[model samples]
Target: MAAAPRWRERLFALYFLSHIPITLLIDLQPLLPAGLQPPALTELLQWYAASFRDPLMLQPPEWFKTFVYCEAFLQLPFFPVAFYAFLKGGCKWIRTPAIIYSTHVATTLLPILAHILCHDFSKAELGGPRTQRERLLLLSVYLPYLLIPLLLLFTMLCNPHYSHTEKRKRK
Candidate 1:
């Protein structure tokens, strides 16, 4: 017999599904002709752009305001699903509050960075022209945020090093 999705699982599924609208909006942004792809590898080529004019203090294009709102709306219901999933799924080892908090932090911060880096494509104006210093800052932060989750996820799945101890009681 197939197992039905638990309430928490159902909620997470919904949260993941809801990302479609945001994806649609993001994908719908104006794009460059095929020839421009190589030079405008970043998000700046579009009518809307994301740039890193400020390092310590980052800003994004106007469309980002709507994007961020959609992101938060997506996340609001997701945290608990992750929490409950951790407890219930036998992956409790990876469910530390710190890890959970980091997940939240990562999700929240990446967009700001992504927006800054891709500002050229952003439809709205954020700030002045990009500088090397701002570029360096964006470059450094980029890969770590992108990589860590994959590392954590891979560890959770492949190696059992991060496993939690949950003993089932005997009848």
Candidate 2:
């Protein structure tokens, strides 16, 4: 039962601290109507969409909107759980929230990535950027959605208590 390494705690702190602004910028802002949304927020959203060479921000499907809403609301509860688990280096009661959050990130990211990678250009609702620079920018924005949760999940799995739990199940 040695103390967690300094680097691990620091990494967790970075992850936890980032979620606050991201929750507001990415998760919460789009939930607002055009009238209520801040002009800066609107411009930021437009820039992101445009980076993909997408000229229009067409309405997402109702089911997709519901899914986004669920993702947005879930961030509220998860923020505290993630902060305590990672920043405090505590494993107790963390596995469930970590699993749920990781699962949500995985499930949501997969379809979008698939559509971006696999869909026919003629038929798709979203299209890839026309220029290499925009494509790179798009990847820069999206790569985090793929990497961070996965890295966090890997960090959670690295806990000795989690390893012990697995070991105990084998006995």
Candidate 3:
């Protein structure tokens, strides 16, 4: 099986590395109890919500909270492992886990993207995006998460090195 380019693996490594802080500082903030959340990070999350006009972050519904819980319990733990594997490059063990992680994240983002595109945040009184421009802006913020994971899923499934193992023949 042909190896995937080292640059691709390195790029993925950087992504996993960057996601660690984002998950801790922003994405997981909603799940943390007020007392447990550091004031500075909490303030950062608030700024993100206000600046992005992201109602989901500002007033997360129960369904959104469930996604956060999955991030905390599932995706969060996998970040370090992915970081290591991608950094090392060609750790076949990572393929399955990466496939699973990417699929799960991509799946979660679909509903979120639909909400951003279709929901009438103005009528909902959720302090969400009131205008089409604002909704598009919020959608931009969430789009990368979906795109990157989908890319990873594609790489995992289609990259020969990731999906196929070669047997060593006796000399």
Candidate 4:
């Protein structure tokens, strides 16, 4: 019998499952056509942007859009695979892919976090968070995307099941 999933594996499974809808609905909205986008979901995205003072979502720059595209094309596909693997537990096949996914996501978030912290939002007509408080609030929203992936990367890298393989012995 396979080992039951640990708490962290279950948590990661939940993360992957939750990410699927978020990607399809909110994260991929900027790339989607108005006709293709659902009205209620679009409203939810708009509400999140306004509430968070997220200029990146409100008026996405080319670079930010590129990131969203990657999320749609790449990470979106991986979510289901990861969800299955993590939920099943001890499937070594997931390790490399999980490592790659975590690294890519964590790398993408660094620049985004920096922009939130350092960008001169006031200069833009459609500005982002202008005050420190607003910026912090926005940062809080983006931070989990960074922190969780980093945690996954660390786990994948350090865990023996993920990092080591057993060799088959022949007579």
Q: Model 2 over residues 51-139: C-alpha lDDT tens digits? A: 66542233454655665677677766677667777777756577667767876886777766654454444544565554556556555
C-alpha lDDT of residue 24 in model 1: 40
- Tens digit of lDDT per residue, candidate 4, span 82-143? 99999988888888899899999998999999999999988876678999999999999999
lDDT of 3 by residue, 1-171 (tens): 798888889988998999899998889877777768888887888888888888788678999999999999999999999999999998999988999999999999999999989887766655778888888899899999998889899899898989896689999
Which stretches in model 4 have alpha-carbon errors above 4 Å? 1-5, 168-171
CA shift at 143, candidate 4, in angstroms? 0.8
lDDT of 3 at 116: 86
Query: Where is the poorest 10-residue window by lDDT in model 3?
Result: 120-129
Q: Per-residue CA lDDT of candidate 1, range 15-40, in tens?
A: 33543543344422322234544444
Between candidates 2 and 4, the one scoring higher on lDDT is 4
Model 1 lDDT on a 0 to 1 scale: 0.45
Q: Candidate 4 has which clashing residue pairs, if any?
A: none
Per-model C-alpha RMSD: 12.8, 4.1, 2.2, 2.2
| Candidate 3: residue 105 lDDT (0-100) | 97
Superposition TM-score, candidate 3 onto the true structure: 0.92
- The 10 consecutive residues of candidate 4 with the worst lDDT sum are 1-10
Query: Which residue ranges in model 1 land beyond 4 Å of their true spot?
Result: 1-52, 55-94, 121-137
Tell me how candidate 2 scores on lDDT: 0.64
Each candidate: what lDDT? Answer: 0.45, 0.64, 0.88, 0.88
